[model samples]
Structures are given as C-alpha cells and as structure tokens.
Target: MIRKANISEIDQILAITKACGERMKEDGIFQWNETYPNAEAFQKDIERGELYVYISEDIVLGCIVISTIMDEEYKSVKWLTPNSNNYYIHRLAVHPKHQGKGIARKMMDFAEELAVQKNFVSVRLDTFSKNIRNQKFYKARGYKQLENIYFPNQSEFPFYCYELPLKK
Candidate 1:
C-alpha cells in the first residue's frame, strides 16, 4: 500500500535511501550520494505532507515525493506543456532488496493518478543523465525528455528533466 509518510518512519526511509545510494555507487551510477536525499529533506517532505511511502506487511519498501513546489532550476528548462503548474517528483527510491518488485512503478502510477485527479498540467521530474535505466523508465511511461539541469553538489554531470503532459 502507498500512503503519506509519517515522522516515525523516517529512520526506515533513510535506511532505504542509504542502501540505494550505496548500490548506485557500486554500479558507478553516481546519481545519489551521502549529501543528497538526506534526512533533513525527507523530514521537510513529511512535514509538508508530500512524501509517500510504499509499504508491505508493515515494512517501508520505497518512497516518493509528489509536490507542486518547483525548483528554481526548473524555470530555465523548456517544458513541453509551457505551464509551471505541475506535480514535481523528487526523492524516488526503492530499497535495494525490494527494487525488482515493481514498487517504483506502482508509486509512479499513484503520483500520475494524483496529478490527473487534481487537474494538474503535467508531471515533472529530473533523473541523472548518466542513469540510463532511469531515463528509459520515464521515457517508456511517456515522459518527454527536456533540457538538462545541473546540481553541482550532486555531480558535475547534467540531470535530464522529463515531463508527462496530461493536457494539451
């Protein structure tokens, strides 16, 4: 089941992200690191009621952030829909142990449904340019690739932005 994250589950959520970061590093993905997706970020997401967790049998398997808040960096991107009002996705991660179970896809489905229900223009997110798997994942779901954005703290490489328009 997917639901809003609670403060008590923060520890479990952090563990999942830490493990994911390690696995990405081992795979030379270099997408997530110790500095990104830290506890503070998740804490804020929970406080704002934007963080959602995927759980099974009372254990948190993955988490995703769905918010209307747009990063300043996104303003420079050439989005397909031209409107800035969209569901912005962030900190999407699945526990390394539970990743192959399609938990991420389910959470994404939830996010897109929420967007459609709320009448949002689209869904927007950024994935590491080097993370080929992630790029394909979004593209397969009909998210159009947009201009690249950089988070210097994360890596020197660019992060590609994607948008899935729900309306014309």
Candidate 2:
C-alpha cells in the first residue's frame, strides 16, 4: 500500500534515505551524494505534507516526495513550466533489498493517480545525467525529457527534467 507519510515514520524514512544515499555514492551517482535529501530535509517535507511512502505487509518498500510546485531554486529553469496545479516529484528512494520488484514504478503510478485526483495536469521530475538507469526508467514510463535544466545544488552535473501528463 502507498500512502501519505506520517510523522511516526520519520525514523524509518531516514534509515532508508541513508542507505539509498550510500548506495548512490558507491555507484557514482553524484547528484544526491551527501546533501540533497537528508533526514532534516525529509522531515521538512513531511511537515509540509509532501512525502509519500510505499508499504507492503507493514514494511516500507520505497518512498517519494510530491509537491504542487517547486521551490525558488527550481524556478529559474526555462523548461519547468509554471503550472501551480501540476505535480512535482522528488527524493524517490527504494530500499536496496526491495529493489528490482517494480516498487519505484508503482510509486510513480500512485503519484499520477494522486495528481489526477487533485486535478493536476502533469507530474514533473528531474534526475541526474549520470543516473542513466533512472533516466531510462522515467523514459520507459512515458515521461518526456526536457533539455538544459540542471539542479540548483548540483550545477556541476546537468539534470534531465521529465514530465508526464496526467489524465483528467
């Protein structure tokens, strides 16, 4: 089951995030190396009602954060269309032990469903250029890649922004 994250799930979320961060670092995915999605940042996301968790049989399999609009840091991007009603996705992480089971794709489907229910037109996300697997995953899921957009923190590394139009 996938649902909105509660405050009680913070510890588990942090553990999952730390593990994912470590693996990304070991695999040379520099976008989220040490500072992108930390515990404090996720806590703030939860407090702001942007975090979502995927659970199965009482265990969390993965998670992601969805927002109605991005922060000012992302506002400068020319490709990021300013649609207040569109959904923005970030901080997607799957438990290493639970990977290869399509959990991330399921979470993305859930995000689209939520966006549709909220009357949003589309769902947007950004992934590091070095994370080829992630880029392919989104592309396979029907997200279109926008050129020339980079994450504010990782300016050294460019990012490919993707958007999936949601059904009304």
Candidate 3:
C-alpha cells in the first residue's frame, strides 16, 4: 500500500532514512550520510506532496520521493531526455528489516506506473557510483546510464545518473 506521507509522519520517515544511512555506511555505500536528506528535506518533500510511504497493516516499511522537480545540480549533466519533463526518484529506501523482499522494486514499479499515468516522458535517478548492486538494479530495469555528478558531502566519487524513457 503506497500513499502520500503526511507531515506528521516525518519522524518515522527520518528514522527509516537514518537507519538506511547506517546500513549504507556499513555496506560502504556512502550515498547518504549525516548531512543529507535530513528532516528539513523530508519536510520539503511532504510539502510538495512528493513523498510516498509504503505501508502494510499500518506499519511503514519504506518510502520513496517521486517528483518532477528538477534539481539545479542536475543541470551540469548531459541527460538522454534533456528537454522533457520527467519523474525523478530520490531518497528511496527500504528498511533493513524489510530488505531483499522486493520492496524497493515494488516502489520503483509504483513510480513508473505513476509516471505513465501522468504522461511523463521518463524517469531519472542518480545512484552511488560505487554501489554496483543499485547500478545493476537500474540497468536491469532498462535505465540508461548517463553523466556523473558529485555530492560533495556524500563522497568525492561521482554519482552516475540514469534515465528510463517511457516513450519508445
């Protein structure tokens, strides 16, 4: 069950992100850390009504941000669908306890469905360059890898951007 997250659910979402950050650090995936995706960022997502939480029997197991808002940082990258409006996925995470249960894939499926429903042209995301697991995941989903960008606080290594075009 995926639904828009309310401002009241901010703390729960933050907890999930914090736990995810810890797990990523443990796994040596520095995509997120103490500085990124804090409460303020989630608040912005909630305000924009872009944050979607995956819940089951009232338990929030995961969340993903699906929005058309383009980040200024993305301007430097050469995107496949540069001129088209597209859905972007950010801060997508499944609780460690719920990992390997296809939750992330389900959230992505939902994102793609929403994009199609909205008549969007494509889906865009940036994955940690060092996270081979996620790179494989996106590639298997037909997302073409594009230019690399960096999140200075997250890592000095480049983050590869990917796009999945909905149009043939």
The lDDT for every candidate, in the order shown, is 0.93, 0.82, 0.90
Query: TM-score of every model?
Result: 0.97, 0.89, 0.96
Worst 10 residues of 2 by lDDT: 73-82
Ten residues in sequence with the least summed lDDT for candidate 1: 76-85
Q: Write the per-residue lDDT of candidate 3 for residues 83-144, one digit (tens) a residue.
A: 56799999998888899999999999999999998888899999999999899999999999
Model 1, which residues run further than 4 Å from truth? none
Q: Identify the runs in model 2 with alpha carbons over 4 angstroms from their true place.
A: 79-82, 152-155
lDDT, candidate 3, residue 62?
Answer: 94
Q: Give lDDT for model 2.
A: 0.82
> Model 2 over residues 1-168: C-alpha lDDT tens digits?
888898888888877877887787789877665676777888888888999999999887788999876756556655444566888899899988888999998999888888888888889888889898899999999898876465666558788778887665
Rank by lDDT (best first): 1, 3, 2
After TM-score superposition, the amount by which residue 72's alpha carbon in candidate 1 deviates from its true location, in angstroms, is: 0.9
Cα lDDT tens digits, model 1, 84-150, are 6699999999999998889999999999999988889999999998898899999999999989999
Maximum-TM-score candidate: 1
Indicate whether candidate 2 or candidate 3 has the larger lDDT. Answer: 3
| Clash pairs detected, candidate 1 | none
